[model samples]
Target: MEFIILVASSFTKLLDPVVLAYVIAGFIIGTIFSAIPGLTATLALALLLPLTYSLDVTIALMACASIYMAGMCGGSITATTINIPGAPSSMMTALDGYPLQKQGKGALALGHAAIGSMAGGAIGAMLLIGLAPFIAEASLLVQTTGKFSLLAFAMVVIVIAQRGKVIKAAMAACIGLMLATIGLDAMEPVTRFTFGFSSLTAGIDLMPVIIGTFAISEILMQAGAAKEDRKMTEAMSAVKIRRRDFIPPLSSIREIGLACYIKSSLIGYSVGTLPGAGGSMGSFLAYVETVRTSPNPESYGKGNPKGIAASESANNAVCGGALVPMLTFGIPGDPITAIMLGVLVINGIQPGPQLMAGQADLIAPVLASLLFSAVVLIPLTLFLLGPYFIKIVSIRKDILYGSIALLAVVGSYVATYSTFQMMMALVLGVLAYYMRKNDFPVVTMLLGFILGPNLEEFLRRSLALSNGNPMTFFTSLDSLFFVILTLVFVYFLAIKKPLQKPTGAAQSA
Candidate 1:
């Protein structure tokens, strides 16, 4: 009954004209940003973070949540209309979506994508609401050792998931940890990496790193590619799309079946709860599993609507799922949520078990905004602006890249009002460009940077409490469980899976 009243009150607060306008505007902006290749939702949020300083906390959070939801769905627009995926999470969608477009069934592909996104977003939101409180309660049992172990597990999982590039991923992650150490030492008050500058003592800000890594580096890469690439107009001509083409037939939805949507959403949500496992992994895993289990597996890569449905649903579902750890445990599952954590902190709200127990007013409204965004996505994408979205891909590359570069520069400076931050952004951008070109998994580096301080702090605190005993981690059952869990994950992701290929080859020979 209390939960019901809280939700009702949140809806009432969100219905204000100003708040609704922000949400709508955010959704539109996010759609445009994510529909363009090289512009991701993370970049959108990072750019918008400075603007939130002047707005009310509730209003700012509402806009962020709405944008997050819209961005996750907008990638499918380009993936289906063109061969390019707007976001990494939509790579799976491109495999089947482009084929459908070639077959002149682009509208059918889009319809399935939109429906799957809506269902997944809604289900993921429900799971977050149901699971957050319980998870918070359970988190109280974990001591410092267990928390340290959990973070170690998350880092190892992230690196191992890099597939054949675990070594490169580890190297990149180590670089991030090194960068994170530039600030004050987590345990002692003494500065370690100041390098004689007073400003360095304050440490590197996350805003500069995030902006530089994602936005500025992307601009550099695009600029380099533009030299050899043909004009957008010459490469691909735009197709004429009508309103009637946006609707999916009833028969098509029935063929996809309710079970697939539910299962995919569940997988997305579960993966989202794991730190560092983002929407890209969720969509990829869900799409692969759906293909493996489908009776018509042969049709998966050749314009199958089920492939589009599975990919879209899982990626969109990740939005709500990623929030669970961020809100309840103060651990961000991915880069976007890491930015959202900054939003909450800037507004004077600290995340943790205490947050869930005491800040229902703030948290409830954000949850309401998520559900409202999913409901609004259907009309906004399908009925109101379906045809116009197809034309988004026709935008000029030079103009887009130029505008983003300008935004990245101004946004980074505005975040700190310091020339040093702008320089930091440029340096990181160059480094990130090289890292990306080398396929070193920059996201893993980011994950390491974000979690490094926390891991170090927890480890130090645990050791201090145990009088420097090395076996202290095994003394507690919670810590022991996490330690074992980390080993198991490492074995499967790093060792057992890699060895399987050789064994199979030997048997075949």
Candidate 2:
């Protein structure tokens, strides 16, 4: 009862004018960032990370939560309006949404997307609140060998989950793991890989990497894509949408059915709990399941509201599920959560099994922000801004990306007041841009960097205890479970995935 009261009171704290203002502002910023192609919630968070240095930790967390939820749902705006998905997860949404736009039902499709986001987001947040403590407790039971196997599992899953690009992903992960070794040794006082620079003593700051990978690289990518988006900007000038039409009708809701929403949310949450799955996978799986089970499966890519519902719901719910590993085990489930972990770390919070028990007050408001943003903000933003979607899409690329680049460079400097780190950000950005051009998954690299320390630490400890015995992993039950689990994931996510027939959206795409 006390815990419940604490959470409820923590939620009520969002009603404070200052906190509420930050949440609303963050949501709007995140929505705009994600609504524009190539810009993402991750980018928004990366750019704003320096600001978190001055803000209260709870406020920063709440804002991040709102931003994440908004990013997931806001992509539907462009997907429904322009046939171009603003986010990768919204690719499935565009298949049906663009058709609906042609039929003059685009606003309604966006409405359906909003409703689905609300349902999935709310349910996912509630599930996180209910299940995190138990998971955290369970996490504590895992010994060192189990921890190593789990990190190994996460790394392998992330690499293989790249679908057909396993080799490239592995290469990126290896690079990330290598980069992680540049700092002081985790155990001893000596630094092995510093390459003889005084600046190497402290290692690379996370801010530089994040700003470079998502923010600076995005700017570099968008600088070249401006011409491609020009036609879409001109297209937006000819299109107009009515705000009132953004509200779904009772008949449409009845058609989509509550069961579909519930199932999709559950699927999203389940997928979110898996390392490397992220929102796109959650949306794809939910949408595929919905199509498989629907009575009129053929209607999905033909402007079906159910398709919008499945995609938006699953993607938005990913925010809640993705946070589990970040909060409990200090392992990021996705890139955004990896950045979010950076935020928590900047605020002096070290996430572990004990974090929940120790800092429920700070955590509750963050979860509440996730719930509130989905339940209230998604629809509110739609109803208020739906009619002006064209205006947003029509913003000049030069001004938008120019501002982002400035912020990225400045934020990199702000991290430690070092020009070297800012230069590092630019260098990393160039690296990320080229990697992305070649279809390398930068996310796996980021995950590998984030998880590398613990992975190495756990492995060395386990090996040291076992007198360098390689079979110790197999001898330990917990370690064996994950070893088998990794094989299971390899078979399914890697081997079995390629043989399956493409879904309705995948086929159409």
Root-mean-square deviation per candidate: 3.8, 1.5
lDDT of candidates 1 onward, in order: 0.80, 0.86
Candidate 2 lDDT over residue span 98-182, tens digit each: 8999998888888899999999999899888888877887888888999999899989988988888899999999988988888
Any runs in candidate 2 off by more than 4 Å, and if so which? 1-4, 226-228, 499-504, 507-509
- Taking all chains together, each candidate's TM-score versus the true structure is 0.92, 0.97
Worst 10 residues of 2 by lDDT: 499-508
How many clashes does the backbone of model 1 have? 0
lDDT of 2 at 244: 78
